[model samples]
Target: MFLLDRPTLGATWGSTSADESRVDGFYLGTYTPDKRQIVLRDSSLVTIPDAWIEHAWSAQLTLLLKDTKRRAEGHYFNIPIPRQPGSESAYFIELADPDEPVMYYTVPAGWQAEFDALPATVTVAVKEKKQGSDSWEDAITIDTIKFSRAF
Candidate 1:
Protein backbone atom coordinates (compact mmCIF):
# COMPACT_ATOMS: atom_id res chain seq x y z
CA MET A 1 0.00 0.00 0.00
CA PHE A 2 2.26 2.83 -1.21
CA LEU A 3 4.90 1.40 1.04
CA LEU A 4 2.71 2.18 4.07
CA ASP A 5 4.04 5.70 4.52
CA ARG A 6 3.28 7.40 7.84
CA PRO A 7 1.68 10.82 8.35
CA THR A 8 4.04 11.72 11.14
CA LEU A 9 6.76 10.62 8.76
CA GLY A 10 5.31 13.39 6.56
CA ALA A 11 2.42 12.42 4.22
CA THR A 12 -1.37 11.92 4.04
CA TRP A 13 -3.78 9.66 2.10
CA GLY A 14 -7.34 10.47 0.80
CA SER A 15 -9.26 11.41 -2.39
CA THR A 16 -12.49 13.11 -3.71
CA SER A 17 -14.36 13.55 -7.00
CA ALA A 18 -17.47 15.51 -8.00
CA ASP A 19 -18.06 14.07 -11.47
CA GLU A 20 -18.45 10.40 -12.32
CA SER A 21 -14.80 10.29 -13.45
CA ARG A 22 -13.33 12.87 -11.14
CA VAL A 23 -9.73 11.71 -11.22
CA ASP A 24 -9.34 10.95 -14.87
CA GLY A 25 -6.27 13.08 -15.53
CA PHE A 26 -4.35 11.84 -12.55
CA TYR A 27 -1.28 9.76 -13.47
CA LEU A 28 -1.35 6.19 -12.15
CA GLY A 29 1.46 5.38 -9.66
CA THR A 30 3.24 2.38 -8.13
CA TYR A 31 6.35 1.45 -6.06
CA THR A 32 7.83 -1.72 -7.63
CA PRO A 33 9.44 -2.92 -4.37
CA ASP A 34 11.95 -4.85 -6.41
CA LYS A 35 13.90 -2.01 -8.11
CA ARG A 36 12.49 1.06 -6.31
CA GLN A 37 11.93 3.03 -9.54
CA ILE A 38 8.63 4.57 -8.32
CA VAL A 39 7.20 3.95 -11.80
CA LEU A 40 4.50 6.15 -13.24
CA ARG A 41 2.35 5.07 -16.20
CA ASP A 42 2.37 7.20 -19.37
CA SER A 43 0.31 4.75 -21.40
CA SER A 44 3.16 2.22 -21.22
CA LEU A 45 5.68 4.98 -21.84
CA VAL A 46 8.18 3.29 -19.60
CA THR A 47 10.27 0.90 -21.63
CA ILE A 48 13.38 1.05 -19.49
CA PRO A 49 14.79 -2.01 -17.80
CA ASP A 50 13.02 -1.57 -14.48
CA ALA A 51 10.58 -3.70 -12.52
CA TRP A 52 7.33 -2.47 -10.90
CA ILE A 53 5.84 -3.61 -7.60
CA GLU A 54 2.19 -3.11 -6.84
CA HIS A 55 1.61 -0.03 -4.68
CA ALA A 56 -1.89 0.12 -3.15
CA TRP A 57 -1.64 3.35 -1.16
CA SER A 58 -1.96 6.99 -2.14
CA ALA A 59 -0.19 10.28 -1.52
CA GLN A 60 -3.30 11.71 0.22
CA LEU A 61 -6.73 10.70 1.53
CA THR A 62 -8.71 13.79 0.53
CA LEU A 63 -10.26 11.97 -2.43
CA LEU A 64 -12.03 9.36 -0.31
CA LEU A 65 -13.31 11.90 2.24
CA LYS A 66 -14.55 14.29 -0.43
CA ASP A 67 -16.44 11.74 -2.55
CA THR A 68 -18.05 9.97 0.40
CA LYS A 69 -18.83 13.28 2.03
CA ARG A 70 -20.51 14.62 -1.10
CA ARG A 71 -22.44 11.39 -1.65
CA ALA A 72 -23.83 11.59 1.89
CA GLU A 73 -24.01 15.35 1.71
CA GLY A 74 -21.20 15.70 4.21
CA HIS A 75 -21.94 12.70 6.40
CA TYR A 76 -19.10 10.28 5.73
CA PHE A 77 -16.86 10.42 8.76
CA ASN A 78 -19.18 8.14 10.70
CA ILE A 79 -19.12 5.50 7.98
CA PRO A 80 -16.39 2.90 8.01
CA ILE A 81 -14.92 1.31 4.87
CA PRO A 82 -13.66 -2.22 5.19
CA ARG A 83 -9.98 -3.09 4.85
CA GLN A 84 -8.88 -4.04 1.38
CA PRO A 85 -5.88 -6.22 0.65
CA GLY A 86 -2.60 -4.31 0.16
CA SER A 87 -4.11 -1.15 1.66
CA GLU A 88 -2.60 0.68 4.61
CA SER A 89 -5.64 2.43 6.09
CA ALA A 90 -9.15 0.94 6.37
CA TYR A 91 -11.67 3.66 5.72
CA PHE A 92 -15.33 3.04 4.84
CA ILE A 93 -14.66 3.48 1.10
CA GLU A 94 -13.51 0.60 -1.02
CA LEU A 95 -10.36 0.67 -3.17
CA ALA A 96 -12.44 0.28 -6.28
CA ASP A 97 -10.91 2.22 -9.16
CA PRO A 98 -7.41 2.20 -10.60
CA ASP A 99 -7.97 3.04 -14.24
CA GLU A 100 -8.58 6.74 -14.80
CA PRO A 101 -10.72 6.93 -11.67
CA VAL A 102 -12.27 10.19 -10.59
CA MET A 103 -10.96 11.06 -7.12
CA TYR A 104 -9.05 13.94 -5.55
CA TYR A 105 -6.68 13.20 -2.72
CA THR A 106 -5.92 16.52 -1.06
CA VAL A 107 -3.87 17.62 1.90
CA PRO A 108 -5.19 19.92 4.66
CA ALA A 109 -6.17 23.39 3.51
CA GLY A 110 -3.49 25.36 5.30
CA TRP A 111 -0.76 22.78 4.97
CA GLN A 112 -1.67 22.09 1.39
CA ALA A 113 -1.66 25.76 0.59
CA GLU A 114 1.87 26.04 1.92
CA PHE A 115 3.02 22.89 0.18
CA ASP A 116 1.48 24.01 -3.09
CA ALA A 117 3.11 27.39 -2.77
CA LEU A 118 6.42 25.92 -3.89
CA PRO A 119 7.81 23.22 -6.15
CA ALA A 120 6.94 19.76 -4.90
CA THR A 121 7.48 16.10 -5.62
CA VAL A 122 4.25 14.11 -5.91
CA THR A 123 4.22 10.31 -5.63
CA VAL A 124 1.23 8.40 -7.02
CA ALA A 125 0.64 4.71 -6.18
CA VAL A 126 -2.30 3.02 -7.87
CA LYS A 127 -3.63 -0.47 -7.27
CA GLU A 128 -3.13 -2.69 -10.31
CA LYS A 129 -6.36 -4.55 -9.63
CA LYS A 130 -9.67 -3.60 -8.02
CA GLN A 131 -10.51 -5.37 -4.79
CA GLY A 132 -14.11 -5.79 -5.95
CA SER A 133 -13.28 -8.28 -8.72
CA ASP A 134 -9.74 -9.44 -8.15
CA SER A 135 -9.51 -11.93 -5.31
CA TRP A 136 -5.76 -11.38 -5.37
CA GLU A 137 -3.94 -8.03 -5.12
CA ASP A 138 -1.93 -7.35 -8.27
CA ALA A 139 -0.97 -3.68 -8.20
CA ILE A 140 2.21 -3.58 -10.29
CA THR A 141 2.38 0.08 -11.21
CA ILE A 142 3.79 2.94 -9.15
CA ASP A 143 4.38 6.33 -10.75
CA THR A 144 6.63 8.72 -8.92
CA ILE A 145 6.86 12.49 -9.22
CA LYS A 146 7.96 14.10 -12.47
CA PHE A 147 8.56 17.61 -13.70
CA SER A 148 5.82 19.32 -15.68
CA ARG A 149 6.06 22.82 -17.11
CA ALA A 150 2.88 24.86 -17.43
CA PHE A 151 4.20 26.91 -20.30
Candidate 2:
Protein backbone atom coordinates (compact mmCIF):
# COMPACT_ATOMS: atom_id res chain seq x y z
CA MET A 1 0.00 0.00 0.00
CA PHE A 2 1.24 3.46 -0.83
CA LEU A 3 1.69 5.44 2.42
CA LEU A 4 2.06 8.71 0.64
CA ASP A 5 -0.90 9.98 -1.37
CA ARG A 6 -1.05 13.75 -1.91
CA PRO A 7 2.72 14.33 -2.37
CA THR A 8 2.28 17.88 -1.13
CA LEU A 9 4.31 18.22 2.06
CA GLY A 10 7.87 17.21 2.88
CA ALA A 11 9.88 16.87 6.09
CA THR A 12 13.39 18.05 5.42
CA TRP A 13 16.27 16.02 6.84
CA GLY A 14 19.44 17.87 7.58
CA SER A 15 23.03 16.65 7.71
CA THR A 16 26.18 18.15 9.19
CA SER A 17 28.99 19.61 7.12
CA ALA A 18 26.88 21.48 4.67
CA ASP A 19 29.87 22.18 2.44
CA GLU A 20 30.88 18.55 1.96
CA SER A 21 27.98 17.97 -0.42
CA ARG A 22 26.29 15.20 1.55
CA VAL A 23 23.19 13.50 0.20
CA ASP A 24 20.20 15.55 1.26
CA GLY A 25 16.97 13.87 2.34
CA PHE A 26 13.26 14.73 2.32
CA TYR A 27 10.08 12.72 2.76
CA LEU A 28 8.21 12.68 -0.58
CA GLY A 29 4.60 13.90 -0.62
CA THR A 30 2.17 11.89 -2.78
CA TYR A 31 1.15 10.44 -6.13
CA THR A 32 -1.81 10.99 -8.47
CA PRO A 33 -2.81 8.49 -11.17
CA ASP A 34 -5.31 10.68 -12.97
CA LYS A 35 -2.81 13.49 -13.50
CA ARG A 36 -0.24 10.94 -14.59
CA GLN A 37 2.25 12.41 -12.11
CA ILE A 38 3.33 12.59 -8.47
CA VAL A 39 3.12 15.74 -6.37
CA LEU A 40 6.37 16.51 -4.53
CA ARG A 41 5.64 19.89 -2.98
CA ASP A 42 2.94 21.87 -1.23
CA SER A 43 1.27 22.44 -4.58
CA SER A 44 3.67 21.20 -7.21
CA LEU A 45 3.22 17.97 -9.10
CA VAL A 46 6.14 16.50 -11.01
CA THR A 47 4.93 14.87 -14.19
CA ILE A 48 6.83 11.64 -14.42
CA PRO A 49 7.11 10.72 -18.08
CA ASP A 50 4.39 8.23 -19.02
CA ALA A 51 7.00 5.88 -20.53
CA TRP A 52 9.10 5.84 -17.35
CA ILE A 53 7.09 3.58 -15.07
CA GLU A 54 3.97 1.58 -15.83
CA HIS A 55 1.95 0.02 -13.03
CA ALA A 56 4.40 1.25 -10.41
CA TRP A 57 2.37 -0.53 -7.75
CA SER A 58 2.89 -3.92 -9.41
CA ALA A 59 6.24 -3.44 -11.10
CA GLN A 60 9.71 -3.90 -9.65
CA LEU A 61 10.65 -0.26 -9.63
CA THR A 62 14.34 0.72 -9.82
CA LEU A 63 15.46 4.16 -10.86
CA LEU A 64 18.60 4.22 -13.03
CA LEU A 65 20.81 6.92 -11.53
CA LYS A 66 24.49 7.70 -11.19
CA ASP A 67 26.32 7.87 -7.87
CA THR A 68 29.30 10.16 -8.01
CA LYS A 69 30.85 7.56 -5.73
CA ARG A 70 30.02 3.90 -5.09
CA ARG A 71 28.01 2.70 -2.09
CA ALA A 72 24.94 0.83 -0.94
CA GLU A 73 21.99 2.95 0.14
CA GLY A 74 20.70 2.25 3.65
CA HIS A 75 17.06 1.98 4.89
CA TYR A 76 15.22 0.99 8.09
CA PHE A 77 11.45 0.35 8.09
CA ASN A 78 9.05 -2.27 9.42
CA ILE A 79 6.41 -3.87 7.16
CA PRO A 80 4.13 -5.87 9.46
CA ILE A 81 1.92 -7.04 6.60
CA PRO A 82 2.03 -10.78 6.08
CA ARG A 83 2.89 -12.55 2.83
CA GLN A 84 -0.68 -13.45 2.01
CA PRO A 85 -1.19 -10.22 0.12
CA GLY A 86 1.28 -11.44 -2.49
CA SER A 87 4.57 -9.89 -3.49
CA GLU A 88 3.96 -6.39 -4.76
CA SER A 89 6.76 -4.42 -6.40
CA ALA A 90 9.21 -2.27 -4.42
CA TYR A 91 10.60 0.93 -5.84
CA PHE A 92 14.29 1.91 -5.77
CA ILE A 93 14.07 5.63 -6.39
CA GLU A 94 16.82 7.95 -7.61
CA LEU A 95 17.32 11.14 -5.55
CA ALA A 96 20.68 12.47 -6.69
CA ASP A 97 19.91 12.33 -10.39
CA PRO A 98 23.45 11.15 -11.18
CA ASP A 99 24.66 9.53 -14.41
CA GLU A 100 27.40 6.97 -13.60
CA PRO A 101 26.62 3.86 -11.53
CA VAL A 102 22.87 4.26 -11.09
CA MET A 103 21.24 3.68 -7.70
CA TYR A 104 19.03 0.61 -7.24
CA TYR A 105 17.89 -2.20 -4.94
CA THR A 106 18.70 -5.95 -5.20
CA VAL A 107 15.90 -7.60 -3.18
CA PRO A 108 15.05 -11.04 -4.54
CA ALA A 109 11.78 -12.91 -4.25
CA GLY A 110 11.19 -12.69 -0.51
CA TRP A 111 9.55 -15.30 1.70
CA GLN A 112 6.15 -14.67 3.19
CA ALA A 113 7.67 -14.14 6.61
CA GLU A 114 10.98 -12.52 5.67
CA PHE A 115 9.49 -9.08 4.94
CA ASP A 116 6.22 -9.19 6.84
CA ALA A 117 5.82 -5.62 7.93
CA LEU A 118 2.92 -3.33 8.86
CA PRO A 119 2.30 0.25 9.96
CA ALA A 120 5.86 1.43 10.36
CA THR A 121 7.59 4.71 9.59
CA VAL A 122 11.38 4.96 9.28
CA THR A 123 14.20 7.29 8.24
CA VAL A 124 17.67 6.40 7.02
CA ALA A 125 20.38 7.54 4.71
CA VAL A 126 21.30 4.99 2.05
CA LYS A 127 25.07 4.74 1.93
CA GLU A 128 27.39 2.88 -0.45
CA LYS A 129 29.95 0.20 0.34
CA LYS A 130 33.69 0.56 0.76
CA GLN A 131 35.38 3.43 -1.01
CA GLY A 132 36.83 1.26 -3.74
CA SER A 133 34.35 -1.59 -3.88
CA ASP A 134 31.50 -1.94 -6.40
CA SER A 135 28.94 -3.15 -3.88
CA TRP A 136 26.09 -1.66 -1.83
CA GLU A 137 25.40 -1.84 1.88
CA ASP A 138 22.21 -1.69 3.96
CA ALA A 139 22.98 0.69 6.77
CA ILE A 140 20.46 1.65 9.44
CA THR A 141 18.55 4.94 9.35
CA ILE A 142 18.25 6.45 12.83
CA ASP A 143 18.22 10.23 13.16
CA THR A 144 21.85 10.99 12.32
CA ILE A 145 23.43 7.77 13.50
CA LYS A 146 24.10 4.66 11.40
CA PHE A 147 23.06 1.15 12.43
CA SER A 148 22.97 -2.37 10.88
CA ARG A 149 20.16 -4.96 10.91
CA ALA A 150 21.75 -8.02 9.31
CA PHE A 151 24.61 -10.28 10.32
Candidate 3:
Protein backbone atom coordinates (compact mmCIF):
# COMPACT_ATOMS: atom_id res chain seq x y z
CA MET A 1 0.00 0.00 0.00
CA PHE A 2 1.93 2.98 -1.23
CA LEU A 3 0.60 6.50 -0.72
CA LEU A 4 2.94 9.26 -1.93
CA ASP A 5 5.58 8.94 -4.60
CA ARG A 6 7.17 11.96 -6.30
CA PRO A 7 10.32 14.06 -6.69
CA THR A 8 10.67 17.56 -5.21
CA LEU A 9 12.68 20.61 -6.24
CA GLY A 10 12.58 24.17 -4.95
CA ALA A 11 14.62 27.29 -4.17
CA THR A 12 13.92 30.51 -2.32
CA TRP A 13 15.55 33.63 -1.01
CA GLY A 14 16.69 33.89 2.59
CA SER A 15 15.41 36.55 5.00
CA THR A 16 18.65 38.45 4.68
CA SER A 17 16.93 40.46 1.94
CA ALA A 18 20.17 40.12 0.03
CA ASP A 19 20.88 38.54 -3.29
CA GLU A 20 23.38 36.13 -1.81
CA SER A 21 20.94 34.92 0.84
CA ARG A 22 19.37 32.00 -0.98
CA VAL A 23 18.71 28.27 -0.65
CA ASP A 24 18.04 25.78 -3.42
CA GLY A 25 18.15 22.02 -4.05
CA PHE A 26 16.28 18.86 -5.01
CA TYR A 27 15.77 15.34 -3.63
CA LEU A 28 14.05 11.99 -4.23
CA GLY A 29 11.93 9.77 -1.99
CA THR A 30 12.98 6.29 -0.96
CA TYR A 31 11.01 3.78 1.14
CA THR A 32 12.72 1.92 3.94
CA PRO A 33 11.10 -0.07 6.75
CA ASP A 34 12.23 -0.64 10.30
CA LYS A 35 11.01 -2.30 13.47
CA ARG A 36 10.22 0.93 15.30
CA GLN A 37 9.40 3.32 12.48
CA ILE A 38 9.85 3.92 8.78
CA VAL A 39 13.04 5.91 8.20
CA LEU A 40 13.71 8.09 5.15
CA ARG A 41 17.42 7.68 4.85
CA ASP A 42 19.10 10.42 6.97
CA SER A 43 16.18 12.80 6.79
CA SER A 44 13.04 11.85 8.74
CA LEU A 45 11.17 8.93 10.34
CA VAL A 46 7.50 8.04 10.69
CA THR A 47 5.83 5.62 13.11
CA ILE A 48 2.89 3.76 11.70
CA PRO A 49 1.48 0.26 11.53
CA ASP A 50 2.94 -2.08 8.95
CA ALA A 51 -0.52 -2.45 7.46
CA TRP A 52 -0.77 1.33 7.00
CA ILE A 53 2.36 1.33 4.92
CA GLU A 54 1.56 2.62 1.47
CA HIS A 55 4.85 4.01 0.16
CA ALA A 56 7.96 5.74 1.57
CA TRP A 57 10.50 8.14 0.09
CA SER A 58 13.43 10.42 1.03
CA ALA A 59 15.11 13.57 -0.31
CA GLN A 60 17.27 16.48 0.82
CA LEU A 61 17.03 20.28 0.48
CA THR A 62 20.45 21.85 0.57
CA LEU A 63 20.51 25.30 2.10
CA LEU A 64 22.91 28.14 1.38
CA LEU A 65 22.73 31.49 3.15
CA LYS A 66 25.11 34.41 2.83
CA ASP A 67 24.24 36.02 6.15
CA THR A 68 26.73 34.03 8.20
CA LYS A 69 25.78 36.37 11.03
CA ARG A 70 23.95 33.72 13.03
CA ARG A 71 26.09 30.73 12.10
CA ALA A 72 29.17 32.64 13.12
CA GLU A 73 27.55 33.31 16.47
CA GLY A 74 26.97 29.58 16.99
CA HIS A 75 23.33 29.64 15.97
CA TYR A 76 21.43 27.74 13.30
CA PHE A 77 18.26 28.37 11.32
CA ASN A 78 14.94 26.56 11.77
CA ILE A 79 12.70 25.24 9.00
CA PRO A 80 9.16 24.67 10.27
CA ILE A 81 6.96 21.89 8.90
CA PRO A 82 3.31 22.21 9.77
CA ARG A 83 1.48 19.20 11.19
CA GLN A 84 -0.94 17.41 8.90
CA PRO A 85 -4.47 16.57 10.04
CA GLY A 86 -4.59 13.46 12.24
CA SER A 87 -0.92 13.99 12.88
CA GLU A 88 -1.63 14.01 16.60
CA SER A 89 -1.93 10.23 16.59
CA ALA A 90 1.04 9.80 14.30
CA TYR A 91 4.69 10.39 15.14
CA PHE A 92 6.61 12.76 12.82
CA ILE A 93 10.35 13.34 12.91
CA GLU A 94 11.74 16.73 11.90
CA LEU A 95 15.18 16.93 10.45
CA ALA A 96 17.61 19.76 11.19
CA ASP A 97 18.47 20.33 7.57
CA PRO A 98 15.84 21.77 5.30
CA ASP A 99 17.17 19.72 2.40
CA GLU A 100 16.54 16.37 4.00
CA PRO A 101 13.85 14.31 2.27
CA VAL A 102 10.96 13.51 4.62
CA MET A 103 8.52 10.62 4.77
CA TYR A 104 4.76 11.04 4.29
CA TYR A 105 1.99 8.44 4.72
CA THR A 106 -1.23 7.69 2.89
CA VAL A 107 -3.70 5.83 5.09
CA PRO A 108 -7.07 5.18 3.50
CA ALA A 109 -8.53 4.48 6.92
CA GLY A 110 -8.80 8.06 8.24
CA TRP A 111 -6.43 10.48 6.50
CA GLN A 112 -8.20 11.00 3.19
CA ALA A 113 -9.42 14.49 3.99
CA GLU A 114 -6.17 15.47 5.57
CA PHE A 115 -4.30 14.37 2.51
CA ASP A 116 -6.80 15.98 0.20
CA ALA A 117 -6.71 19.24 2.11
CA LEU A 118 -2.95 19.39 1.97
CA PRO A 119 -1.71 22.71 0.62
CA ALA A 120 -0.44 22.75 -2.92
CA THR A 121 2.57 24.67 -1.74
CA VAL A 122 4.37 25.20 1.56
CA THR A 123 6.68 28.03 2.56
CA VAL A 124 9.87 27.28 4.47
CA ALA A 125 11.27 30.33 6.16
CA VAL A 126 14.62 30.95 7.79
CA LYS A 127 14.83 32.07 11.42
CA GLU A 128 17.87 32.71 13.53
CA LYS A 129 18.65 33.54 17.16
CA LYS A 130 20.62 36.72 17.18
CA GLN A 131 23.26 37.48 19.78
CA GLY A 132 21.89 39.36 22.79
CA SER A 133 18.42 38.60 21.44
CA ASP A 134 16.19 36.43 23.55
CA SER A 135 14.21 35.00 20.61
CA TRP A 136 14.54 34.21 16.98
CA GLU A 137 13.86 36.72 14.22
CA ASP A 138 12.76 36.12 10.65
CA ALA A 139 15.76 36.37 8.38
CA ILE A 140 14.34 35.60 4.93
CA THR A 141 11.64 33.71 3.10
CA ILE A 142 13.07 30.50 1.79
CA ASP A 143 11.57 28.43 -1.02
CA THR A 144 7.88 27.83 -1.42
CA ILE A 145 7.89 24.09 -2.07
CA LYS A 146 5.00 23.25 -4.34
CA PHE A 147 3.64 19.79 -3.61
CA SER A 148 2.07 17.66 -6.36
CA ARG A 149 0.68 14.29 -5.39
CA ALA A 150 -2.25 12.15 -6.53
CA PHE A 151 -4.43 10.97 -3.68
Candidate 4:
Protein backbone atom coordinates (compact mmCIF):
# COMPACT_ATOMS: atom_id res chain seq x y z
CA MET A 1 0.00 0.00 0.00
CA PHE A 2 1.15 3.55 -0.67
CA LEU A 3 -0.11 6.97 0.23
CA LEU A 4 -1.25 9.31 -2.52
CA ASP A 5 0.30 12.74 -2.07
CA ARG A 6 -2.84 14.80 -2.38
CA PRO A 7 -3.75 16.99 0.56
CA THR A 8 -7.05 18.27 -0.86
CA LEU A 9 -8.44 14.79 -1.32
CA GLY A 10 -9.31 14.19 2.33
CA ALA A 11 -10.24 15.96 5.51
CA THR A 12 -7.39 17.13 7.68
CA TRP A 13 -6.58 14.83 10.54
CA GLY A 14 -3.67 16.74 12.02
CA SER A 15 -2.32 20.23 12.02
CA THR A 16 -1.39 21.71 8.64
CA SER A 17 1.88 22.89 10.12
CA ALA A 18 4.79 22.81 7.72
CA ASP A 19 6.63 20.41 10.04
CA GLU A 20 3.87 17.82 9.62
CA SER A 21 3.31 17.15 5.93
CA ARG A 22 0.40 14.75 5.38
CA VAL A 23 -1.12 12.60 2.65
CA ASP A 24 -4.76 12.08 1.79
CA GLY A 25 -5.60 8.61 0.52
CA PHE A 26 -3.92 5.24 0.35
CA TYR A 27 -3.39 3.72 -3.10
CA LEU A 28 -3.05 -0.01 -3.60
CA GLY A 29 0.44 -0.64 -4.93
CA THR A 30 2.47 -3.47 -6.42
CA TYR A 31 6.06 -4.17 -5.38
CA THR A 32 7.67 -5.63 -8.45
CA PRO A 33 10.90 -7.60 -8.46
CA ASP A 34 12.67 -4.46 -9.60
CA LYS A 35 14.58 -2.95 -6.70
CA ARG A 36 13.02 0.12 -5.10
CA GLN A 37 10.34 0.18 -7.77
CA ILE A 38 6.66 0.46 -6.85
CA VAL A 39 3.67 0.70 -9.18
CA LEU A 40 1.07 2.98 -7.63
CA ARG A 41 -2.60 3.48 -8.51
CA ASP A 42 -3.74 7.01 -9.28
CA SER A 43 -5.53 8.46 -12.29
CA SER A 44 -3.25 6.06 -14.15
CA LEU A 45 -0.28 3.81 -13.48
CA VAL A 46 2.65 5.64 -11.85
CA THR A 47 5.99 3.92 -11.39
CA ILE A 48 8.08 5.51 -8.66
CA PRO A 49 11.84 5.24 -9.13
CA ASP A 50 14.49 4.12 -6.65
CA ALA A 51 15.55 7.73 -6.12
CA TRP A 52 12.17 8.38 -4.46
CA ILE A 53 13.17 5.84 -1.81
CA GLU A 54 15.47 8.40 -0.27
CA HIS A 55 12.69 10.85 0.54
CA ALA A 56 9.31 9.04 0.36
CA TRP A 57 9.92 5.76 2.13
CA SER A 58 7.68 6.94 4.92
CA ALA A 59 4.45 8.99 5.00
CA GLN A 60 1.43 10.02 7.05
CA LEU A 61 -2.06 9.23 5.82
CA THR A 62 -5.50 9.87 7.21
CA LEU A 63 -7.55 6.80 8.09
CA LEU A 64 -10.83 6.78 6.14
CA LEU A 65 -12.63 3.84 7.65
CA LYS A 66 -16.43 3.96 7.80
CA ASP A 67 -16.27 3.99 11.57
CA THR A 68 -16.72 7.63 12.47
CA LYS A 69 -14.58 7.36 15.59
CA ARG A 70 -11.52 6.13 13.77
CA ARG A 71 -12.13 7.84 10.45
CA ALA A 72 -10.03 10.89 9.73
CA GLU A 73 -7.37 9.81 12.23
CA GLY A 74 -3.74 10.22 11.22
CA HIS A 75 -1.58 7.14 10.72
CA TYR A 76 2.01 6.72 9.70
CA PHE A 77 2.73 4.40 6.76
CA ASN A 78 6.19 3.06 5.99
CA ILE A 79 7.94 0.63 3.68
CA PRO A 80 8.99 -2.56 5.47
CA ILE A 81 9.48 -5.22 2.82
CA PRO A 82 10.71 -8.59 4.01
CA ARG A 83 14.03 -10.03 2.95
CA GLN A 84 11.92 -12.96 1.83
CA PRO A 85 8.40 -14.23 2.24
CA GLY A 86 7.46 -16.47 5.20
CA SER A 87 7.39 -16.28 8.98
CA GLU A 88 11.14 -16.84 9.23
CA SER A 89 11.65 -13.39 7.78
CA ALA A 90 11.56 -10.75 10.51
CA TYR A 91 9.54 -8.42 8.28
CA PHE A 92 6.78 -11.03 8.20
CA ILE A 93 6.41 -10.82 11.97
CA GLU A 94 4.60 -7.52 11.90
CA LEU A 95 1.35 -7.00 13.87
CA ALA A 96 -1.55 -6.79 11.43
CA ASP A 97 -2.43 -6.24 7.78
CA PRO A 98 -1.33 -2.65 7.25
CA ASP A 99 -3.34 -2.77 4.04
CA GLU A 100 -6.23 -2.44 6.42
CA PRO A 101 -7.57 0.96 7.45
CA VAL A 102 -5.81 0.89 10.82
CA MET A 103 -2.42 1.49 9.27
CA TYR A 104 0.64 0.47 11.31
CA TYR A 105 4.20 -0.06 10.11
CA THR A 106 7.87 0.59 10.84
CA VAL A 107 10.41 1.48 8.19
CA PRO A 108 13.55 -0.65 8.07
CA ALA A 109 16.42 1.54 6.99
CA GLY A 110 19.29 0.28 4.79
CA TRP A 111 17.23 -2.26 2.84
CA GLN A 112 18.35 -1.03 -0.58
CA ALA A 113 21.02 -3.70 -1.01
CA GLU A 114 18.64 -6.49 -0.07
CA PHE A 115 15.97 -5.15 -2.39
CA ASP A 116 18.39 -4.96 -5.30
CA ALA A 117 19.19 -8.65 -4.90
CA LEU A 118 15.59 -9.75 -5.31
CA PRO A 119 14.84 -12.03 -8.23
CA ALA A 120 12.99 -10.90 -11.33
CA THR A 121 9.82 -12.58 -10.10
CA VAL A 122 8.46 -13.40 -6.64
CA THR A 123 5.25 -14.42 -4.92
CA VAL A 124 3.94 -12.41 -2.00
CA ALA A 125 1.92 -14.02 0.76
CA VAL A 126 -0.80 -11.88 2.22
CA LYS A 127 -1.47 -12.50 5.90
CA GLU A 128 -3.35 -10.85 8.67
CA LYS A 129 -2.99 -10.96 12.46
CA LYS A 130 -6.25 -10.11 14.11
CA GLN A 131 -6.23 -8.22 17.37
CA GLY A 132 -5.31 -10.33 20.40
CA SER A 133 -3.76 -12.97 18.20
CA ASP A 134 -0.19 -14.24 18.42
CA SER A 135 -0.14 -15.86 14.98
CA TRP A 136 -0.70 -14.73 11.42
CA GLU A 137 -3.39 -16.25 9.23
CA ASP A 138 -2.58 -16.63 5.58
CA ALA A 139 -5.24 -14.72 3.70
CA ILE A 140 -4.12 -15.33 0.15
CA THR A 141 -1.16 -15.38 -2.22
CA ILE A 142 -0.67 -12.44 -4.52
CA ASP A 143 0.02 -13.34 -8.13
CA THR A 144 3.55 -12.76 -9.33
CA ILE A 145 4.50 -9.66 -11.31
CA LYS A 146 7.15 -10.01 -14.03
CA PHE A 147 8.67 -7.12 -15.94
CA SER A 148 11.73 -6.78 -18.10
CA ARG A 149 14.27 -4.29 -16.85
CA ALA A 150 16.45 -4.93 -19.89
CA PHE A 151 16.97 -1.71 -21.76
In candidate 1, which residue ranges exceed 4 Å CA deviation?
A: 1-116, 130-132, 135-142, 149-151
**Where's the lowest-lDDT run of ten residues in candidate 3?**
70-79
Local accuracy of candidate 2 as per-residue lDDT tens digits, 13-86: 11122122123321112111222343322333333221110110111223342222222222212111112223
Note the Cα lDDT for every prediction shown.
0.25, 0.22, 0.25, 0.29
Question: Evaluated with TM-score, which candidate comes out highest?
Answer: 4
TM-score of 1: 0.19
User: How do all the candidates rank in terms of lDDT, highest first?
Assistant: 4, 3, 1, 2
Model 4 stretches astray by more than 4 angstroms: 1-118, 130-134, 137-151
Error of 2 at 119 (Å): 2.5
lDDT of 4 by residue, 2-80 (tens): 7566564444232222122224222213233343333221122222221111112222343762322122433222233
- Candidate ranking under TM-score, highest first, comes to 4, 1, 3, 2
User: Which stretches in model 3 have alpha-carbon errors above 4 Å?
Assistant: 1-116, 137-151
Better of 1 and 4 by lDDT: 4
Clashing pairs in 4: none
lDDT of 2: 0.22
Instruction: Tell me how candidate 4 scores on lDDT.
Output: 0.29
